[model samples]
Target: MADDPFQSRFAADASLLPHMADLANDRVLVALLAEADYRAASFLDQRLLTDRVGREWMAWDALPDLGAAAAGPHFIFHIGHVGSTLVSRLLAEVGDVLPLREPMLLRTLAQVAERIERPESVWSPELYRTRLAQTLGWLGRGFAPGQRAMVKASSVITAVADDLTGSDGRALFLHVPLPRYLETILAGEASMAETLAQAPARMARLAALLPDFPHALWQLPPVTRVAMSWLCEMATAQRRLPPDDPRRLWVDFEAMLADPAAALMAQATHFGLPIDPARIEAALAGPIMRQYSKAPEHGYTPDLRRELQAQAAADHAPAIAEAIAWVEALAARYTNLADLPILGDQSVIQEVRCSS
Candidate 1:
């Protein structure tokens, strides 16, 4: 490595590497270079995105130890279409916190586990465990004193929760209530299109979860297919998350949106991150709430979303109604899932209580 000013400066900062951000077709690890800090980045995308700066190809043999430099790198595990992104963005607003949203490395590991193939000669579960821990250690390095590192994983990555969190690690399993989740999928053309396009992949994931998932599930109504996918994800969350683990917390999207300050503060407390209540309030009132968390240029407000949902419901009345009915019928069919909110039980409204 040459000693150029930019390279020299960034090299010393152990917080730079995001493990397996670029796993090439040939199994080499390519590093996607960005500024050391992602404070100005967007959370709308699955991965932590930044202005393209440069790239570096790294050999595992040459990889340095980062774990010692890292502080506590907490995780925000969530179900898709929820407000996980919003929570991540708010946390990053604290200036000292580095929030990595959906690192591709974790996703690759999850896929590898499902397929049961070692893509590289040197790759193994133990290798991934060591490399990921070291990378996380580096990520845990706070930009300043007492800063925290947080990772917001994609919902599907719940398959590898054990590897990610390890024993005695902490995580927050986040999801939207069943009705809101269905409406979220049905209300947006993009959402509906994505659901259709990813149907095959979702089915493959469900097959892993439900041993007897019928082959005819694909032939069922599209609405039912989406419902099944949601169920599979929920089941994953429930399975991986230890109900009695004090370190593990469960949250619903509706609760967070209803009370941003309290919810954010509670999450901060849960993760052991130090935050000023005044600063959190300021951030909530500022751009984080006013702008689209994903694409800040587009303004976002509660009223705007409600209006859009109403318009969508009116435009796609039949489809929305069918989707709702399909979910209701499924809920009733599975009496064993009575405790699950999606199963149409009103008592399940606040199963995972947050600190009010």
Candidate 2:
């Protein structure tokens, strides 16, 4: 055996990926990407990468087959509610851009495809990995071979990024929750309360199932789910307070109202996103902002009222009281963008994010 030539080639950079991938383990991928510096600052497109590899590299596992594609690079991604809609809409304004929404279905598919055990929940793991690749494939298929796709993802399936296939596609991931958003989170406890009322009660249950996944790639999702659990718990406590008692929440709605764009912009920038500061300011000036306005019949729920009354004592009560006051104080700050089209453009689904 002259030093096992086949084994050596198997782990070689090219085969290393598919081989390690076949092992049903995502560790190699994680280590490689973290080392690659996804957070590095850059304004240039990856035109040179095409020269190095001869052809473009779309994502490995997630993309659709679009048959024929247009020219230029693409931006794809996953994002939460934190100013992402604004960023995506703005990015769409950029020429030659084909943006994808949450990409939730693909996310579920990836989880199912390479996951250790199939998930029996909302997502279909069996179809996860390839579907995302298929999406990239389809998106890329519509473009030239060397075109790049800047994709923003909803449920971040970074492990599946390399697996995505199509034209030459490289991804830049941005974590949109920034300092201002965190401050708002810390300050606006009532908002948290409101979030709880609206969020699914099953969220807490989902956080506990992380250990069941096959690969470390699956761990990231639960980190988010776990955080949700804490917020939901805190919210449950906040809902128990009386209207007058303060300390139920964290931040102020009045201040948030005065500078909606400013507050939102801080969140956008915090995630290393590229957003126009001027537009952020413009967004605030338009009427219809804040969590929700107070209407006599269309106000707080019974679950909330009881939660507040029950929490009037002990440690949780004060936090909730403060939050309620914070929400009440800013009642005038909200404009309910639900009616206003995105960026003031009411067209196909591309420009609209109207409220329910």
**The best candidate in terms of TM-score:** 1
TM-score for predicted model 2 compared with the true structure = 0.33
lDDT of 2 by residue, 1-356 (tens): 12656333322222111101222422112112110222121111232123222332223332122223432224333222233333443333322233443433344444554443544443344444334443443333213232233444433343344455233433333222122222233334664454444334324322232224222223323223223433323222222221123311121222333344554554344333456766555544332132121222234322333234334323344444443333223222333212211111213212111211
Candidate 1: regions farther than 4 A off:
1-15, 19-37, 43-52, 67-72, 117-122, 215-217, 314-336, 343-356
| After superposition, candidate 2 runs with Cα above 4 Å error | 1-79, 117-132, 141-151, 156-168, 176-179, 182-356
How far off is residue 31 in model 2, in Å?
38
C-alpha TM-score for every candidate: 0.80, 0.33
lDDT of 2: 0.32
Model 1: pairs clashing at backbone N, Cα or C within 3 Å: 44-294, 66-138, 67-137, 70-140, 70-141, 71-140
What 10-residue stretch in candidate 2 is worst by lDDT?
26-35
